[model samples]
Each structure stands twice: as C-alpha cells, then as structure tokens.
Target: MAKSVAVIISILCILAFSGLSQCHEEPEFFVNGQVYCDTCRVRFPTRISQPIKGARVAVECRDRDNGTMTHNAIGMSGDNGEYNLTIKGDFENEICEVVVMKSPIAECAEVMEGLNRARISLTSKNGLLDTHRYANPLGFITSNPLFQCTQVLAELDLSLD
Candidate 1:
C-alpha cells in the first residue's frame, strides 16, 4: 500500500531532522585563571607574592540586557593557584566573569581594587578557536608587606624613594 509506505517515510524524515537539530546544541567552555596574593599591596603579583591555595573561584554568566544572572559554576585553585572551571552553555548574549569568592589565607583575604574580577567572553561566534579561555588573575592584598618584597620591588624599580 503506497499510503502505508508514505506514512513510514514521513516518520523517518522527521526523526532525521530532529537529530540534525540536536547536533547544534550549545557547546561547553573551559575557563582558566589564577588566584594569588599581592604581598606588596601593589594590586599585582611580584616575586614575593605567592599563590593562595584552596581559593574559591566562580564563573558567572549574566544577561546583558537586565543584568540577571543566567548561569554559574564554581572551582577551586590548586596549590599553584591555578583553576580550570568548565561552564556548559553558549552565552552569546550574556556577559561572563571569573570572580574570587574566598581566599584560604586569612591574612591576605582582602580583595583589592581592579583585581577582584576578570571579564571574559564565552561564545564561539567570536573567531577565537581555542576552547580554553584565559582570564586575568584575580587577587587579594596581604595585610602587611612580606620581608622579601622590598628586595623584589627594588629589583623591579618599584621601591619607595
């Protein structure tokens, strides 16, 4: 019966199209960064600075229009202050940032200006071929300058007069 065959063919075609659509599902991203202490309180890392182990970091995606949070994932820094966080979504219309949530070192837990968060783009539409996106290092300032910081700064021409 031609009618029976037609029905079966139509069902097969529907299934094929659905599978094609599923192939275009959102892609995932690997965001990497570091969390460290600015021992000299200069808002940047120096030779005297050290990594903050066990620091809590997070990747947050927000809607650009209304500033509503869309997605978020947390990660922890290793002993070397490195973190690799995986976020699953295609955020072409959202703004994403890597923020420092907590520092394991109590003495160096104060977030410094312009060094607390790093903005990143998380969409494939941009010509960036690498799935791994690097963020600016997020850091906190230590309560007091380390003893070796004076020598480190002097070498870098950042010492006090």
Candidate 2:
C-alpha cells in the first residue's frame, strides 16, 4: 500500500512541475510590418502610397550600454509590401529597430530621412502575452511626386483650409 501511494505521489509531482513549466514557457517573438513608396512626396504614407515588393528589411538590435550591434535579421517584403520577421532570442536592455535595406523599385529607392527606421522592443518583460510587435510603416521617397499627387495634395489642402 505504501509503495502504491509513493508511486502516485511521484506521478502527481511530475505532472505539476510540467504544468508549471508550460505556464512559464517563453513566447515566440514575431515582428510584422509593411513598406511603402511615398508617391506624393509626403513625409508620411497616405492612401495613395504604393507598396513596394521585393524590398529588403532588417531588424537590428544594439546593446544599450556600448551601442554595439547584438542581433541582426533580414527579410524581404512580399507582393503586398508586407514582411513578417521571426526574431529569435531575447534582447533585453538593447535598442532594436527595423531598418530599410533596399527598395526594388527604381523610382522609390531613396530612403526618407526620419522614415527609414522604426524603434521596437524585443523583450517579453512587459506584461504582454502576445509577442507580436507591429512596427510603423517604413517608406521610400520618390524622385518626384506622381501626377495624380497634385490633385491629392490639393484636396488635402482644401480639407485643412
């Protein structure tokens, strides 16, 4: 009788420990974002902005204390300018940013000054169960605004007025 009780207790302890580990399991981090071409020469993206396919994007993390690069991952945009990057490992105390590497479209190859990279956090220390982080849309600048952009700008000005 004592032997059976010990066996059952051991199984129960094992099950309890397994459940606790599962509860504390680390979550997978995923970063989802998009890249666009500013056809209207606007610093920000608009409804008329075109998505650039085959654009290269990179997620880089630098050590906050030394400013040295710690982690880097590259991904390419799909036909819809959407990119999903699976970031591995935790980058605690590091400053991470999603940066534009290259644009496949010739007209939208130039990176805008402040829109090239967006900062993001990669640690799960925050009270968020979902590890998915949505980054701001990064965009490339066109050499000249598209012809229709003039009408769009006019409408915008009229609305503001």
Candidate 3:
C-alpha cells in the first residue's frame, strides 16, 4: 500500500514541476522602428502625418547569412511616423537592417525620386533598434518609379540548444 502511494506522489510531483517550467519559459521578443522621407525630413505617420500603412519590411540576419533563418514581418507607421515590428526568438549580437523598396510608384515628385526609400539598422537581440541606413537613393528614384515604399524591421540571433 505504501509503495502505491509513493508512486502516485512521484507522478504528481513530476507533473507539477513540468508545468512550472513551461510557465517560466521566456517568450520571443519583437522590436520596431520607422522610416521617413529624407527630403521632407519627417517620419511616416499613418493617421497624422505621412501614411505608412501596408508597408512591408524584411529583417535579414547578417551574421549567419541564412536566408531560411531570415525573418520578415509587415508593419505600418503611426501618425508620428513611427513603426513597430515583432521579432521571434532571442537575438544576441545579431546584425539586422530595416530595408525599404522602390520600384514602381507615383513618379511625380522629383524629391521623392531620390528620397522615397530608407532603411534602419536593428542591432543587438531581444528586439532592439540600432542605426539607420540609406541605400540606392538615386537608383531608386530613377530606375523603377512604380514601386516606392519604406520598411522597418529587425534581425534575430538564433540560439542552439
């Protein structure tokens, strides 16, 4: 009879410990940033300022260079020209960039021709913002005028167990 009680008690203890571990597990972190027009020198606010809804951003991990491990999430800027993106997993010392695309959009403004796209650097892990990068502004304005948009995202550091 004592042996039976001991076995039952051990099972209950195991279950309780397992549940505690799950509850204490850390969740994936997400970081966010924004893009703006260099010509205007203002951010892309959704409702208040520049519209930044339906904007797509790609966060590629530069350290690993694993295209499969790259994370891509979509975001929209608020009225204050700010955007927020969520990244899954822990990314310690991970180098990332928030890239914008320009291809075929309204090719009207000459300023926008050279200042339509932008990028922001997302350095570190657990969702953090780092620096801002600008690439191919002139090409973006003159090459493809149909697609013009901005993206803000992050890169994550994948941990191996």
Best by TM-score: 2
The pairs that clash in candidate 2 are none
> Lowest lDDT 10-mer window, candidate 3?
152-161
- Candidate 2 local lDDT, 21-86, one digit each (tens): 986665568998999999988878777899989899999999999999999999999978999999
* Residue ranges of candidate 1 with Cα displaced over 4 Å: 1-22
Best by lDDT: 1
Candidate 1 lowest-lDDT run of ten: 152-161
Candidates sorted on lDDT, descending? 1, 2, 3
For model 2, the superposed segments whose C-alpha errors exceed 4 Å read 1-9, 19-27, 158-161
**Model 2 quality (TM-score):** 0.86
lDDT per residue (tens digit) for residues 128-157 in model 3: 443223332221122231112221111122
Q: Could you give me the TM-score of model 3 versus the true structure?
A: 0.40
Give the alpha-carbon lDDT of every model.
Answer: 0.90, 0.89, 0.41
Better of 1 and 3 by TM-score: 1
TM-scores for all predictions = 0.84, 0.86, 0.40
